[model samples]
Target: MDFYELVKQRQSTRAFDTERMVDREIIARILEAGRLSPSACNAQPWHFIVVDEPDLKNKVADATSARLLGMNHFTKQAPVHIIVVEEKVNFSSGIGGLVKDKHFAFLDIGIATAHICLAAESEGLGSCILGWFKESKVKELLNIPKNKRVVLDIIIGYAAQPLREKRRKSSEEVISFNTYQ
Candidate 1:
C-alpha cells in the first residue's frame, strides 16, 4: 500500500475479528517498522512486550476494562497486544532533553508507535493504541520492573467492521501560514 493511503487507512479499530489470528510475519513487520523509527539522539528508549498467548492476552485485556464506565470491553476480542515500555534514555538524549526543556523520550515513543500502527495498516491488520488501562495491574501481569513505565497498549487483529470516514478539521481551520491565526 502507498504510504499516504496507509496513513489514511490507519484508525483506532474498536471491533476485531476474534476468530482470526494475525500472522506472525505481519506482526514481525510491524515491529520492524517500530525498531527502525528514529529517536532523540538515537536513544531508542523503548521496549516492546508482545502478548499473543490467549490467557495472558485476556489478562492484559482485563486490565484495560472499566466495568463502571463500560469502556474498552472490546479488548478481550483483540488477538494481539503490544505493550510499549519506557526505558531509560541514553546519556546524550537525556542531556539534550534537559537542555532543551522537552521530554524527547515521549516524542520518540509516540513516533515509533505511529510507525507500528501504519505498518499494521499496510499489512491488512487493524490496530488501536489504548491508554486507558490499569497500569499497576499490567505491570504485575507482565512482570514489568517498577523502574519501567508502560506507555501504550496496542491491540491488533483483523477488523470485524468497515472503516468509518475520518472526521477532522479542514486545512484552513487547522493550519496557518507564517503566524498563528
Candidate 2:
C-alpha cells in the first residue's frame, strides 16, 4: 500500500490472534524503520527490547493490566511486545533541548515508534502502542536500568478484531495557513 493508505489503515489494534507467531525478519524490518527515523541533532536516543518469548510476553502483559479501568486486557493475546527505552541524547541534541526547553528525547522516540507501527502495517501485521502500564514493574521484569525510561510498550500480531471507522478532526478544523488559527 501507498504511504497515505498505510497511514489510513494503521490503527491501535487491541485484539490479536494468540496462536500466530511473528517472524523475526519482519520485526527486524520494523526496528530498522525506527532506526532510520530522524532525531534532534541525530541523537537517536532510543532502545527497543523485543519480547517474543511466551513467558516474558506474559510478564510484560501483567505489567500492563489494570483492574479498575480494564485497559490493556487484550495484550496477553499479542505474540510480540517491543519495549521502547529512552537513552541519553547526544550533546548537540541536549543543547538544543536546553535552549528550546523541550524534551527532545520523547519527541524522537515518538517519531521512531511511528515508523515502527507504519512498518508493521506494511508487513501485514497489527500493532498497538500501549502507554498505560506499570512502568516500574515493567522495568523490573525486563531488567532495565534505573536511569532508562520506558517510553512505550508496543504489541504486535495478527489482528483478531476487524477495522473500525476512524474519527478525526478534519483539515479545516485542525490546520491553519501561515499562522495559528
Candidate 3:
C-alpha cells in the first residue's frame, strides 16, 4: 500500500488471533524499519527486544497489568511483543553532542516506533503501541541495563476483530495559518 493509504488504514488493533504467528522475516523487516528511522545527529539510541516466547510474553503481559489500552485483553494473546528502549549513552556521540540532548532519545524512539507500526500495517499485520507499563519491572524482566529506558511496547499478530474507527479533530480545529490563537 502507498504511504497515504497505509497511514489512513493503520489502526490500533486490540483483538488478535492467539494461534496466528508473525513470520520471523516479517518481524525482521519491522525491526529494520525502526532501525532505519532518523534520529537527532543520527545518534540511533534505540534498541529492540522481540519477545515471541510464550512464557516471556506472558510475563510481560502480567507485568504490564494486561489493561494497557482499556479493555484490550488480546494484547496478552499476541504472538509477538516488541519492546523498544533507548540507550542513555549515544554511540554516535563522537560526531557531535547528541548525547547531551536528553529528550532526543525519546523523540528518536518515537520515530522508530512509528516506522515499525507503519511497516506492520503495510505487511497486513495487526499491531498496537502500548505505553502503560511498570518500566522498572519490565526492565528487570527483560534484563535491560539501567542505562536504557523502555519507551514503548508493540504487540503484533493477526487481528481477531474488525478495525474500529477512531475519532479525530478536524484540520480546522487543530491547524492555524501562522500563529496560535
Candidate 4:
C-alpha cells in the first residue's frame, strides 16, 4: 500500500487475536525500522526490549494496564510488547539539546515509535503505542536498570477489531500559511 494509505489504515488497535502469534522475523523487521530512524547528531539514545515469551509478555502487559482507569486493558491480548528505553545522549547531541533547551532524545524516540507502528502496518499487523503504565513495575519485570527511563510500550498482534473511520481536525484548523494564527 502507498504511504498515505498506510497512514490512513494504521490505527491504535485495541483488540487483538489472542489465538495468533506474530512471527519473530516480522518483529525483527519492525525493530529494524526503528533502528534506522534518524536521531539528533546520531545520538540514537534509545533501546528496544522485546517481550515475546508468553508468561513474561503477559506480565509486561499487566504492567501496561490499569483497570480502574480503563486504560490499555487489551494489551495482554497482543502477543508481543516492545519496551522503549531512554539512554544518555552523546556529547554533541547533549550540547545541542542544552543550547536549544529541547529534549531531543524524546523527540527522536517519538519518531522511532512512529516508524515501528508504520512498519507493523506494512507487515499486515496491528499495533498500539502506550505511554501510561506502571513504569517501575515494568522495570522490575524486565530487569531494566533503575537509572534508565522507560519511554514507551508498543503492543503488536493481529487485530481483532475492524478498521474504523478516522476523525481529525480540518487542515485549516491545524495549518497556517506562514505565520501563527
Cα-based lDDT for every prediction: 0.94, 0.94, 0.83, 0.96
Best by lDDT: 4
lDDT of 1 by residue, 1-181 (tens): 7788878878899999999998888899999999999999999999999999999999999999997899898999999999999999999999999999999999999999999998888888899999999999999999999878999999999999899899999999999999999
Candidates 2 and 4 compared by lDDT, better number: 4
Worst 10 residues of 4 by lDDT: 64-73
TM-score of decoy 1:
0.97
What residue pairs clash in candidate 2, if any at all?
none
Candidate 2, superposed: residue stretches over 4 Å from native: none
By TM-score, rank the candidates, best first: 4, 2, 1, 3
Residue 156 of model 4, lDDT score: 97
Query: Per-prediction TM-score, please?
Result: 0.97, 0.98, 0.88, 0.98
Better of 3 and 4 by TM-score: 4
lDDT of 2 by residue, 1-181 (tens): 8999999999999989887999999999999999999999999999999999999899999999886789899999999999999999999999999999999999999999999999999999999999988999999999999888999998999998888899999899999999999
Best by TM-score: 4
- Of the two candidates 2 and 3, the one with more favorable TM-score, higher being better, is 2
Ranking by lDDT: 4, 2, 1, 3
Error of 2 at 111 (Å): 0.3
For residue 141, model 3's alpha carbon misses the true position, in angstroms, by 1.7
